[model samples]
Target: MKRNLREKTKRNIGLDLTRIFAFLSVISVHFFLNTGFYKIPLRGKRMFILATLRTSFMVCVPLFLLLTGYLVSAKKIPLEIGNLKKYYKKIIPVLLSYGIGMTVIFAIYRLRGDRSYNLQKLVFGILGYKEYSWYVNMYIGLFLLSPFLTNIWASIGDKKTHLALIAVFSLLTVGPTVFNVNDLTSLKAIFAAYDDNKINHLLPGWWYNIYPLTYFFLGAYLRTYVDFKKLRPAKVFLALILIIFASSAYNIWRSHGGSFQIRLWNSWGSLQNTASSICVFILINTLAPERVNEKIERFLAYISKLTFAAYILSALSDKLVYSFVNANLGSVKESMPYLPIIILSSATLALAMAAGVEFLTEKILEKSVREK
Candidate 1:
């Protein structure tokens, strides 16, 4: 048992790093959002550098989506009635965590002087949209469908067909978004004539929002078929570096050093976003050492488990840190040089506070659950 546990740890340490970095990316992305990075005009070499960080960090959520699909694919959960209860039970803790996080965010909002929120508002907020927890809505839909999706994955025995499915999904979800005039900042759209009405109707993008499934299915496909053992880690790393630059460079050119929208198409379906994500996801899974240090493994694993909570809890960190910084540290542009410090401070504070809440939440969840 010990040998098996150690082996699992070695293999998963890379994923642990993935989770940890992904969570950090979430915090960093919020740094841009909360620090007024988006409200200011983006241009010049400095903005390009910041854009690169934004591009790189944007892959965090995609990495998690891919990880979900990959991990789910590795398990053989059929869509049978017998397996339904066991599979669905995994969601109890997620729901509980979200509830706790949501209440905290709503409470903080009230304390921030939004007195319009009452118990009724809080109750409505549970079923409705809450801050920093949009991912929860997307995830719940994906989670409910995973069993059927994985079963569909199992049915597709042909590699060619699987690739074709991914291509189609990408084309519909990512292709139009990356090339349409409706979104002028996209690479192809940036080069072409700018016309909001001149959309590429040939490639209908009505289905672009299904990108969560795209990432999920791609994750499962990579896990099920790709032979990462055969690929050179150096080559993959080089490709990832190039993709990040290509992505950031395009955004820089489009911005023209003024009136640029950094968050536009920064969604999961962006080409650079998708490209960076797949590349990093592949590299991480491929390049991990066979035997990681046990202590490092434990640390990585512990922090990784708290990632979701840290992420949910960042609603508070973002509020508190930025509130203080915006008040004392000067304007967002003026504080550009100190971006690293600001983000680090917020992330550290969030993770520290989330650690205790997460532990207690887990214990409560454990007791609340009754085995059949």
Candidate 2:
């Protein structure tokens, strides 16, 4: 029993460390995206460096979703409503965090003499449209639907279906968009029709982004069906580095010629981003340490619990930080040499504050839950 307990502790440490790193990666992504990183010209190695960071961090959210799918698969969560209710209850913390964050944001804007807030926008914000937490809604849907999805995954019982679905999803979404290989002008019309025909109204706007669902299925499929023993860690690491370099360099090359929208697409959601994300996700899962010092494990576990709060706080605070940086440090273009340091510092500060608040709030909330 003692040996078994140690093994469990060891196994959990990997997952905890993964979450902690992914959370910090996401904070870094938000800082760069919300700031003037994009506004800087693609002139030298600086823009290329930014591209690498962006492409790498783009995997952060997908990594979390993949982790979610892996746990669900590994645990063999039952295809039952009761299990879902337990999952649903887990989201209360997310809702509370969003509410608190948004209220703080609203207060900041009002105090800054910005009166753009209104009833309609508030409703939209609560529903997670036109905001950072839009992924939360899609996540909830994926959580509720996971049992059914994983059921389908089980029924297929083959790698062929997995490859087929991934291919199709890639074709429709990331592949062509990244490479500009296909004439997507007509595809835009299809989406435009979907929008105008009120098809979007059939579900929340957030649900329309199908990447999350694909990622959810991919996660389950990989964890349940694939054998990583054959794949060497060195090869996987090499692949990861290659994808990051190629993707970042490709985007930099595109920026010299592509239109603004085209450049943005290539930089942000290109094939490189998706491929790198997959590599990193697989790399972490396959190669992470099974155990660590007890102190380190405890620290990771605590920080991992605050992942959602860190994400929410960073999202809310990014704009304020950007504003402050612009006002104090001049335009990001002028601070190009120091941009990375500034952005990283802001993300770290936000993560620290978020973790502190989440720690205290969770204690209070869990106490209430226990009392009830």
Candidate 3:
């Protein structure tokens, strides 16, 4: 029993490494996309390559959702009420942190003579309204639904039944847009309006949420029903490779045909996001040499602890670093060859700053609670 427990703990650690790497992939993709690095000469091809890489990492969000389902749905049919309450407490800090970070960014933008501030926009963004905040909104929505979803998972006895449900949801997610169904126009229109002309309403809300919860449930289902211990590592690696190739080819084809819309196709399907996530998962789980994996695991764990801080600081770091670099070096185009160096430096500075802020926040919280 002790041995079994130890093995389980190791597996969990491995999983955490997977999650952290996925998050890093997300950061890298966003950094490149937002910095206009993709627009560099011959960068389109490079972007395509990165997109392929990104798709593999796209699986990361789903992996996280899967972790949520497994953790939340442990025991009983339809969920235990106690678990719901517990998760609510757990998610509060995440929401609050994201809120505080968003406010900081908003204030900075406003102070920089950007001149755009509205209560509704602020509230909406806080609620995961537009841009990257959508992930937060999706997470909040999933947390709210977890109890019911957990219940559904508990009651379903057969694997086929759960898989069938997933298929139905995926179809509901992809069908209307794929076929361009006019009847569903109202549904699309409603979401568009609700998201304030943003693409939030499409695909059962889960897809707009990047289907993280759906993937989470799927992972939990597999964990509960399947005995993956008997599976060969090579098989898993091969399967991941195949999936990456297929997803990349499909994305490239779609992109070339001009049939791709950023919100619907690129963002939703995100071939790179999906592929990179798969590759990372498989590599971490299988091909990574023992010593290498241990080092990586440690590094990823450190980064994961600082991920929220890094995200918040990235915005500020971008502004500060860009200003400094511009002041010293003139146009980015002229300094094109040093772009990678700039990104690396900026990211390092941001990570350090974020870590400092997080450490201070934790110390303050500890003191406040002690006083209370």
lDDT of 1 by residue, 31-70 (tens): 7787677766776666667778887888888999999998
As for TM-score, the candidate ahead, 1 or 2, is 1
- Looking at candidate 2, the ten consecutive residues that score lowest on lDDT are 193-202
Quote model 3's TM-score: 0.68
The candidate that wins on TM-score is 1
Runs of candidate 2 with Cα error greater than 4 angstroms are: 9-11, 108-124, 128-131, 178-208, 226-230, 257-270, 333-336, 356-372
Clashes of 2: 0
Compared with the true structure, what per-residue lDDT tens digits does model 2 show for residues 1-372?
998877765646656767877776876676566556666666665556666677677777877877777777655556678986775676677667766665555656667787887656666677764456766766778776777776666667678877786666655555434333323346564333112232212212232256666666667777767666556879989999998787766656545523112332443334665677667777776776666677887887877877776676675567767777777777545655666676577666666767766766678688988999
Q: What is the C-alpha RMSD of each candidate to the true structure, in Å?
A: 3.1, 5.9, 7.0
Winner on TM-score (1 vs 3) = 1
Candidate 3, number of clashes: 20
lDDT of 3 by residue, 285-330 (tens): 4543433455676776676667665665566666767776667765
Clashes of each: 1, 0, 20
Clashes of 1: 1
User: Which regions of candidate 1 are displaced past 4 Å?
Assistant: 1-11, 108-114, 182-195, 262-265, 369-372
